[model samples]
Target chain A: MRAVIAEDLALLRDGLARILRAHDIDVAAAVGDPVALAAALEEQQPDIAIVDVRMPPTFTNEGLVAAIEARARRPGMPVLVLSQYVEQLYARELLLSGAEGVGYLLKDRVSEVGMFVDTVRKVAGGGTVLDPDVVTGMLTHHGRNQAMARLTRREREVLGFMAEGRSNAAIAGKMVVTAKAVDKHINSIFMKLDLPLDADDNRRVLAVLRYLQTD
Target chain B: MAREDADRAALRDVNWRMILRLEASISVGIGLLMLIIWALAGARHFWPAWVWFGLAIPLALQVAIRRGLRAPKGHRLLAAHGAITCVLASILLAIWLLAGARHAFWPVWPILGLGVVLVGHAWVRHALPTAREQALADRVEVLTRTRRGALDVQAAELQRIERDLHDGAQARLVSVAMNLGLAEELLSKDPQSLTELLAEARSSTLTALADLRTVMRGIQPPVLADRGLEGAIRALALDLAVPVTVGGEIPGRVPVPVESAAYFTVCECLANVVKHSGALQARVDVGYRGGVLSVAVRDDGVGGASLAAGSGLRGVARRLEVFDGTMTLTSPAGGPTVVTMEVPCELSSPRT
Candidate 1:
């Protein structure tokens, strides 16, 4: 998959480009700041864009805003947002465009090269991914926390992995349980959270997240 | 400023003196005319004395007004009182002398009344703070409190940062060092054991990095540094568990120290809302107007939050006090708690 990377830090930007190129994923453009990122997006039209939360000029949420604007121009333009810190609010905002083809993770996740590459591929292939920290943050303080509390421990575990855009089989492998059992736990979570059951994984993740945010 | 006012007052005095001289000339001419008329009609009874007293009334009032204006600022009212009292006493003396001082000294009663009122005015002026001194005293009181508060906040911040580093990053680095040493020893013997030890070391270093990041954030958040107070607040609002609607704007960046203090104050308020309020939603409003930067955090929660109730908010208050800032909280027992903090400030250029 072809990709574009936008990060202000030179060290991190080069590292990202090198990683994607090593993974046989073509990195068509790597730039700093939203202005350059915008120009690159227009020219390259990469399969995915990896963005940092803070970028110049006015190094605030410029890159995050750029990613959203890019998606607005072309719906479901797969983008993965990275930040030094994880925030449920930024995650919710990124997912607002379309949970599918979106991922929000901490910048530290780049160190786990295999997992990072897999996330980029999953996002480019139209799957939603959120950091486990964001999910934990959601489960602890959101208005939906009470609903999360009603979930059984095993079912909540399944829900967490599911929100991270893992398939039932991937979740089963992580839990060392059967795939069918993982599916059952997911179903139980949906029912307990009072969400409509869905066949698509991204929609199921979105439904859980829609309720996971503040009511 | 005082010199200019005095010069203007002197010019006014000269004008008044010129008018007084003309009036005095006119009065003496009238009195002399009356004297001549009395002599022509066989002088008797001396009724011109009453006419002179009537003329003195207007002159006395103008003199009293000028005395009030000429007195120093704090003493103006008392000067006016004394001048009016003297005028009344002089009138009483004139009445006594004109009425043939053989009576029971009735002028003493009216003169004594005027003296008593003037003395009372002087006593009150001495006892209470006059306008200028009172304002100075108030300013001194504020400066003293805020200076002490700034020192206290500085000391407390230093202590907290030291403790966090000692327990978090320092401890993790120690573990990582030990793990790396063990990995080095195992490298010559068992590759499997060495690999596990190396992985553990890497994990420990990552944890240490996370710890350092947290401490850095506490000291100065990256977003706050990038965005200034207005945008920093919006970023903070987004992170809270409760849905917070952020409103208002600032024209330019706040100074770094003030920006950090305001950001932490809002952070503490939000943390309280999440922990104590159990409310479904919250609101944060930030605006700068008329040289005052104000931030109000409102939560729809069970209230009863007070500064005396928790050290967290009190610390926030102290932190703000250093900047000559103030916080007011209104949280009645049932719902809708609002905490508003204001700081007098000037907007700095966007970046230094």
Candidate 2:
């Protein structure tokens, strides 16, 4: 898989490229600045581009602009954006651009190598990935929906884990319970919210996210 | 200046006219007195021929008067000469009148004294010290204001440095210390194996490193130096909870001092809006016109703001002053406080 990387900091860009290359992923080109990356995008076509949310010449939203430009030029290209903080406005902007094959995740997610790689693969394969924290932050503060208001605290925790794309076994380990009990909690949450019982991680995450994200 | 000089010259011409009128009147009176003397004692040798020599006094007075009028701002000398001539001329006229026809020549004595008073009062009242004193006072005031503005700017810069250090580096160091303390406790307990404890120590080290870098960035924002004002401000807005509508654009790179002041002003303004204001939105506009860079931050929040000592407004005012700039705040009691800060790019450095 061919990918382009745009990050303002040299160390972070080099580190991310090394980690991706170690997983046998081809980094077609890596740029430490946004302007050069934009020019490169015009010349070279990459299947996927991983961008940092802030980059130079102005460290503000160069990454967001780069993502928009790439999507505009090649609508089929998959882009994953990394940010230090979970910002609702940025998430809204990304989701509003037709959510297929787009990903927004915290930079710290790279610590979980397996899940991070899986997310990259999913995004490249035409799936949408949203950071569970971003969804949680947005829903917790501003959500006024009745179904969300009725969720028990334990059910909310389960929902959070689900949104993080966690398997039942992992949720069980974190909750210190049997996987059978975790399964029951997940089923109870799905029933209370009246969502389809899809077993796929992406679809399950999307359904829960779409419900919680509703106003 | 030319107009004023012309006005003075016109006044001088008027004074000359007055003196000429006095001399002409006196000349006609003296000629009348001579005719009366000749009529009383026919042109024979009753009076000595040398007595006619006293007539030279009036001619001499006219020469002195004309000379005084020629020089600019020399009214004192000119007026003195005219007054003396008028007094001497008056005494002669009085003696001649008493000796011959005895007309009331003493009336002209009062007119002579009036001229002296007029010249002396004009010099003392409006022409001399008022103009010089005013110029001196103005110079002193301008110097004082410039000095005060310079001092205020420097003091504000120092205050900002203190604030950044206290909030950023100091706070991070405290957290680092706490993290290290916890890691040490875990090491001493050995509840986990040596490997796990080492990992904990490693994690603390990484946390400290990250915190320190954050502190460094907060101090200066290295990206601003590398990129420009636009990039730095956008980065700041991206993290705000409320909507930040950026209006207008800044062209090219500004000098570091200008950029730093503008950057911090925006930062402080945004922080106050988020923390204090119940407003849902903010607007920031930046533009350049006629060599001045203008920055304005407005919020639709409760707007009772004061620059009472120790307020952030005071600090901002001082900061702008350093760049030969000013900060004006228009905040009423209920809503909408607009802070406008303007600074000239190429002004003489403020001197204390």
Candidate 3:
């Protein structure tokens, strides 16, 4: 898969490009600023883009806005946002462009190379990935607490992993449990949230949509 | 209740004038009664004239004091001194007349003494404070105190940041470097241990970054920069454990320093709400009205939050006072606690 990266820091930009290249994903264009980033998105139209939250020319949320605008032009355009800090408002803004093919992770998460690359691949494949802080941020909405409070500690863990875009097998592997157990936990979570049973990926998107409507 | 207050106020309002007028009339009656006595005694020397002059004392003092009160700014006391001199001269003249106008003008000696005192008083009265000077001195006092408080808060904040960086991120980075150096040494002999060290170093760097983020947030939150005060407050309300309903509107951004001060105050107040107030719910209201930015945080719980009770709020008040701001708290026991803070500032036009 082809990808574009827009990070102002040269070391991190080069590091990201190297990591994606090592994973056999083509780095179509890696630019340092949003201007070049916009041009690259228009010309190359890569399958996915990894953008930083802060960038040059008013170094506040430039890359975030660029990503949102790009997705506005092309619905569900895959983009993974990286930032030094995790804020719920930014997460919600990114989710507003439709939860599919989007990821928002703290810059620190890149240290977990295996998980970071897996998240990139999942996001490029039209799946969702959210930082744990970001998930907690969205879940802190007013009325969601009652429904989420009904979940057991283990079910909550499974729910968190699900929100992070892990499949049933992946969650079972992480939790050291059988795949059927993971399926049962997810079913229980869905019942508690009062959501219709659907495919796993669709349910993740609906979870976000359901809470967003409450506000 | 209202009628009682009105009647009491009416009584108080007329008291001074009524008392003065009644005394003057009684003095007149005494003068007339003495005139009748003198008339019965034979009325040749006109001794009633002395009685009228003596009766003039209270009326004369009243006139003099009324004029003193009406005297312009610094001249009130001097006017009062001038009134005393007049009263003294009049009394001495009356005594001289009563003394059969003899003994080498003895009243002149005492009158000279009065003249000396009046001159001294007039000379010193100008040096005393006028109303405007007193007001300016009060302003200067506030400026001095707030400046010192601000410096103290700043010094304490700098020390905290320095200590946090020294102990947290910088130490982590040093450990990361040490681990990396050891990992390189083990790369040839122990490949498995080498991988473990590398993993540890990676996590250490991430922790260092986290520590740095915390320090940077203490300085100035990036979210506050992304969105101004109102939006920043909303973002803060979301992260809180208690459900905080943030209400109100801000048309344009306040100055950055003021915004920072106001934001941190809200943060401190909300922290208190979570920690001390056994509150089930909290609320924040932010609005800019009449060139003043006001923020009030309220919680429904066991009340009694006070600046004197906690250094957290005292520091908050000190920070706000630097900008000529004010903070008021109303946290009666067994009820809701509300902290209201306000700062007067002009807003620049909103950025497009």
Fnat, one value per model: 0.24, 0.00, 0.59
**Model 2 chain A: worst 10 consecutive residues (lDDT sum):** A135-144
TM-score for all predictions? 0.77, 0.53, 0.78
Name the weakest run of 10 consecutive residues (lDDT summed) in model 1 chain B: B231-240
- For candidate 3, the per-residue lDDT at B21 reads 88
The numbered model that scores best in DockQ is 3
Residue B240 CA displacement from its true place in model 1, Å: 7.1
Best by lDDT: 3
Model 3 TM-score, all chains together = 0.78
Q: Can you rank all candidates by TM-score, best first?
A: 3, 1, 2
Itemize residue pairs with steric clashes in candidate 1: none
Go through the candidates in order and give each one's DockQ.
0.23, 0.07, 0.47
Clashing pairs in 3: none
The better candidate by TM-score, 1 or 2, is: 1
Please tell me which predicted candidate would have the highest TM-score against the true structure. 3
Ranking by DockQ: 3, 1, 2
Best of the two (1, 2) by lDDT: 1
Evaluating just chain A, the predictions reach TM-scores of 0.89, 0.76, 0.89
| TM-scores for chain B, listed for all candidates | 0.81, 0.51, 0.67
Candidates 1 and 2 compared by DockQ, better number: 1
- The DockQ-derived docking category for candidate 1 is acceptable
